[model samples]
Target chain A: MNFLESIKVAVNCILQNKMRSILTMLGIIIGIGSVVAIVSVMQGGQQEMNKTLEKFGTNRLIIQLNWNEWDKITSRDYLTEGDIQAVREMGEDIVAVSPLINYGSTAKVGKEKEDLLIYGVSPEHILIENIEMVKGRFINDDDYKSKRAVIVIDEKLADKLFEEEEAVGKQIVITAGSQNNTVTICGIIKAQDSALGSIMEGNRSTVYMPITTVNKMFYDDYLYAMSVKVADSDKIDEVGQKIIDLLHRRHRNENKYIMQNLTQAIEQVNQFTSTFTLIIAVIAGISLFVGGIGIMNIMLVSVTERTREIGIRKSLGANRNDILIQFLIEAVIISLIGGILGMLLGISVAYMISSLAKWPPVFSIGNIILSFAITTMIGIIFGVYPAYKAAKLDPIEALRFE
Target chain B: MIKTKNLTKIYKNGSIEVKALVDVNLHIENGEFVAIMGPSGSGKSTLMNILGCLDRVTSGSYVLDGVDVSTMGDRELARIRNRKIGFVFQSFNLLPRITALHNVELPMIYSGISARKRRKKAELALEKVGLADRMHHKPNELSGGQRQRVAIARALVNNPAIILADEPTGNLDSHSGEEIMAIFQRLNKEGATIVLVTHERDIALHTRRIISFRDGSLVKDEPVTKPVDAVDMMAKLSDMKDKHNI
Candidate 1:
């Protein structure tokens, strides 16, 4: 018989027992569903992590002073101007370095006063931290060298202060413990929107001022943290090590500084998610394996149950191959249907999970195709034995079967 | 036309072998309606199985229409069965899930006939069996007589060389059995060859010839002095019932 005719027979058989067919499909559905769901969650989590990492700058490394007990007493474990200059001459690895100093300050603009974060950064901080401007310009080297009292306010702070009008070129007053410094709002950076960005920016409004101006106003030459940008992502760890080594040697201690980079963490995160996906896929695969056995069992039962019908078919001139193909196609159709249902359920489940986790969920066509292929393979692998048994049945014996 | 020479069948399981048939020689000309009658386990069913191409003879040669098929392989025998032989069973053997029309179309489906043509042939066959009005009903929805008619339609739709029936009326009431016999009689009169296996002497009397078997051996082969007209017989029985009511 032609394939279409055999498929029709198979489909008709399945339709005859709608409840049995659906029940037979449940195992495959769950197997494919869980696999797809886990893959989706892991894929979404990975993508979300990549975005967060990219938002925070994957090539940027943070260098912090890890003060020893002796150094803590004297408060002498910090990078100085001479160390920054030395690191600048290191290599292409150190593309740019931004010295950051954070402090809490009260800001007043036309009778509006609220606590805001005071930031001390160089002009290169704009590139290192992926900071985008909404309006006006960032602090230049001229402002830092001349000790100009200039600051950049984010759009949120601008909206808070001006309510509707622009805050560019406006005077912003920063008072920290009675030390007040009036600085011009030289630039307005775009406000953060993503959850990670919002958390990074925090509830406190942020205002950026030149490092020279902050150092003069705070009366301290010490730095809080330094943001180091690497030219190549692959060379981030090597470059970070070189900078740390230089600083350690220069300071005459090996444990005085700590370095953190997004590149290193990305590998760990990628490894974790891939392993997590693998583990979940394995668990789901076990269920699918059980499902395959279920198919085989049901197909055997079906062959036995329909033995007389098979005999009737054989008497009607069905070749061994015809009967085999009919049953094989029935199994394939069952699993394929289950696979389709599983994928839909899995995607919806993945979407729900990602939404609950507040992560961006992504769907891919490759995984859906993979699920289909796997389900079909499962159908064939499990279908062969039962079909063979049916084909080998003797016409007389089968016709006599009850 | 059917011919068998010393056709023997031995069914073996482990060390024990049962000789279901032994050197049974038989022949029936084209357009002949023949019946093989025996008690249960008398080798008649085995002879039918071999003649229908559902089984192979353990020894000797059997020829049908011009081809020797005694030693044919499973695949070849299946093809022969499809193209050259039709089988009717005691239980009607109609697939319960499908309509009568589809059941009738089953044989043609495996023979690679186009669906439209198959449907047409099946409808004609159903009409021949007097099941034209019940074509859309499933076996479960059909009476035993109607189901047997569907089986007969399925048998005829293939247009095979010989119709082989094993107890075709064994499960039916006398009236339904008479109806089934009447259809077979009609087909035989239309030049169809038929070979049937049955245990009923009355049923065997309806055929043109009777071949009796006992203890795995052919005991008798004789032409009927006068074959019963099944259609006339059924009509007479109904008329007798009308007379009894009066």
Candidate 2:
């Protein structure tokens, strides 16, 4: 028979028993649905993480003190002003280097005392970290040269201290290590919310001031950490390694400080997402395997039920290949129908959950195609035995079957 | 034409072997009406199965229309059965879901005939069996005699050279059985070779010859006189229909 004719017959047969055909397709539907939903959610999470990381400035690198076991005996090792100069001298690709010093202190604004970390850094640090100003100006180079005690307070602190009033040019008392320092607020900085809202929490109640003034008022030895920005994101790793080697030589043959690339952190996050997606996929594959077995069971039952029909066709000049093709077509049809419905249901569920929970759930065409291909293969592989049994049935015995 | 030499069939059940046919030699010419009569379990069905190419002989050479069917593959045998022979079962084995027209068209489908031609041939065959108006009715909706006529139409649709009937009238009433026997007689007179298996001696007497089987062997083959004219009986029924128009 021609292709259309064969398909017509197969469709007619399936339509004759609609309930049985739909029930047989249910296994594949569930399998594909779960796979699509899980994978889309994972893809959405990964995209969200990438967006958050991108908001942190792609070319930025964080330089913190390692202080591991091998460097425990090294005395007084920290990122200094000279190390920042050396990192700038390494290449014209380096954009800016800002040394940061932070101290936990109590700030008093008209008897409302709050414990907060005051971050002291050059005005260039604001530009490098992509920080935005809400009101007034940040500490300029003149403030760092003159060691002026001027600070920038976040919007949250501004709101708490002055209610709706402007807080710029106001003086606040900061007490740390028995030394009470009064600082003029030069600017009101807007809080930065990361793509995933992680950094927003950190910027809620912090303050920023000139690093030179912080050095004079706080501990006089060395700064806490240094943040570096590069001109191009692709050179972040190379420039970070050069800075690390310079810091190691500057620390007198001790590589006590740790250099971390933001790109690397992003990579770690991506790896975590990939691993999580793989685990979910493995579980989904197990369910699909069970679904394939269910198909095989149903197909075997169908073959037994249609023994006389097979015999009649065989007696009517249908070859073994014809019988095999017929049964395989039935199996593939079940899986194809199930797969399509499952994909629809899965995407709908994913969309519902994403909208309800405010989580990004990405619908990926690759995942849809992969699920369909795998289900089709499952149908063929699991359908072979039953089809063979039907094809190999004895014509005489089958015809004699009631 | 059909010929069989030393035709034997032995069925195996685990360790036991049951011989269903034993060295039966038979020849059937074209355009002949022949009947095989025997009691149940007398190997008549087995012989019919072998003749219908539904079963393979254990050791024999059977030739049909110059083809060595004894050694033919399953697919080749199926092809021959579709194109060269038609079968009528005692139960009128029409597919339950299909109407009489589709049932009649089934055999031609396997013969690779076009749908239009198969429909035309099935309609002609149904008309020949006097079921032209009942083509849309399913087998269950037809009477016993009408169902058998539909089965006969199905058997004749492909214009096969041979018609094999295995107890074709076993389930019908005596009047319907006689009507079916008359149709077979008219088909034989029109040069369609037929081999019928029946237990009724009266049915056997209507055929030109009768072959009797017993204990897996042919016991007797004899010619019978007083062969009936099926066309004349159909004409008589038509005359009765005309007279009953009051």
Candidate 3:
């Protein structure tokens, strides 16, 4: 018989035993469902990680003095503007270097005070951090050269301190240690909105002033750390090592500084995700294998139950090939239906979990197509033996069967 | 036309062999009505199986409608069975799940006939067997005789060379049996070739000739001097039934 006719016959037979057919398809459904769900969730998590890492700045490296030996540290171990100039003159790979000093202080307007974490940076900090401005402008060379009492604040702090009034061009008094100074708000930078960004920043209001201003007003100009931006990110670690070596030589000290970059962090996250994906894939494979076996077992039972029908058809005019095709089509249709249901289940589960965990949900056409192909292959692979057994039945014996 | 030369069938069960049919030579022409009569295990059913191409002979030749099918392979034998022979079994083997129309269409389906033409031919065959109104009923919904009629419609839908009935009336009541026999007789009168197997002498009397098998061999083959007309017999049965009711 033709393929369409065989499929029709198969469908009729399956419909005649509705519960049995669905039971046979259950293994495939669970198998494909877990695979799709796990894969989609993992992809969504990886995408979010990559986005956060990219925002953290891939090409930026932080060089910091090791503070564990604070009692043994000397004044000569501190990084200086001379060291920053030396590193900038080292090679073309170095984009910009700027000192970064953080201090916890309080800002005041009249008698009202709000706690703030203040950062002292140079003009190049804008390039290294990719800071986007909302109004006014970032710290410039002119502000650093003249030691202008000007500062930049984030939009959140601007909204909090000045309320509806513009915070830019306004002055806020800051108290640091036992020293206090008045600084004008030169600009307002955009606030971070990502889940990871918010967690890292917490509720601390942030304000940025020129390093010279902070060194002159708050403390002595003994730098503890510096941020460097490299042009070719592929060699970021190597360039970081070169700069550290140069600093250690210039300061005439050993093991006093360390370098950190985002590339290594990115690699660690990738490794973890890939390992998890591999484990999940193995589990999904086992499920599919078990499901395929279930289909085979059910198909064998169906073939045996329909032996008399096979005999009748054979006696009428059906060849072995006809009988084989009929049963094979039935098995394939069952698994395919299961696969479709499983994919839908997987997608919904992924979305549900994403919403609960606050990760982006991703669905790809390639994955759906792959699932279809795998299910079809599973059907053909598991169905052959049962269909062959049915086809090989002797017409006389089959007809004689009760 | 059907012919068998030195037809022999042996059943082998491990070390033991049962000779079902031995040295059976038979011939029946086109438009002939014949009956094969024998007791159980007399090799009559074996001969029927060989004639239907459901089994192969051990050491003999059989030709149906001018095709030498004794040595044919399983595939070629299946084709021969599809195109040349129609079988009506004692159990009225209509597929229980499908309607009578689809059961009649089964043979044409295997023969690769289009759906529209198969439906038309199945309907026509069912009409011929006087089951046109019951065409959509499942087998369990029909009486035993109507189911046999449906089986007969399925058998003849493809217009095969011969109709082989192995005790087609065996499952029915006397009235239904007579009705089945009358249909066979009418078909025979319309230039169709028919071969029936029955142990009942009354059923054999309706055919023009009788072939009797004994112990794996054909012992007798003779034409009936006077054949009983099944239509007349059925009419007599109904008349007697009516009188008894009164």
- Give the best candidate by DockQ: 1
For candidate 2, lDDT tens digit of each residue in A32-135?
Answer: 88878877876776677666565555688878787565437354576667777888777887888888778777788888886667778887887577677899
Higher-scoring candidate on TM-score, 1 or 3: 1
DockQ of 2: 0.38
Q: What overall lDDT goes with each candidate model? A: 0.86, 0.81, 0.88
Please give, for residues A1-402, the per-residue lDDT of candidate 1 as tens digits.
779987887888888888988888888888898888878777777776666687677689988776444445235557887778888889777788888788888898779997788888888888887678878899999998998999888888888888888788889788967777788888898775454444555667777888888888888777757888889988888888898899888878667777888767778978887788778878888988888988898889889999999999999999999999999988888889889999998989988887777676677899888898999999999999999999999999999988
Off by over 4 Å in 2: A1-6, A16-20, A64-83, A92-95, A98-226, A230-260, A356-360, B14-16, B114-120, B132-137, B229-246
Alpha carbon lDDT of residue A208, candidate 2? 81
Q: Score the docking of each candidate (DockQ).
A: 0.84, 0.38, 0.71
Candidate 1 residue B208 Cα shift, in angstroms, is 1.1
Instruction: Name the runs in model 3 displaced over 4 angstroms.
Output: A65-78, A101-120, A130-136, A145-224
Instruction: Sort by DockQ, best first.
Output: 1, 3, 2
Cα lDDT for residue B44, candidate 2: 96
- Residue A54 of candidate 2: its Cα lDDT? 59
Candidate 1 per-residue C-alpha lDDT over B1-246 given as tens digits, one digit per residue, 9 for 90 to 100:
799899889999999999999998888899999999999999988888898898889999999999999878999999999999998999988888889999999999899999899999999998888778889998999899899889888888888999999999999988888889998998998999999899998899999899999999999999999988888889988998899999
lDDT of 2 by residue, B1-246 (tens): 889999999989999999888999988999989999999988999999889888899998999877889998878887888887888888887777778998888777667788899889999999999999999999889999999999899888777778999899899876688789989988988999999999998778889999999988988999887775655655776787789995
Question: Candidate 2: what lDDT?
Answer: 0.81
Which order, best to worst by TM-score? 1, 3, 2
- Per-prediction count of colliding residue pairs? 0, 0, 0
lDDT of 3 by residue, B1-246 (tens): 788899899999999999999988899999999999999999989888889999899988998999899989989988888888899999987889999999999999899999999999999999999999999999999999999999999989889999999999899998899889999989999989999999998999989999999999999998988988777888898899999999
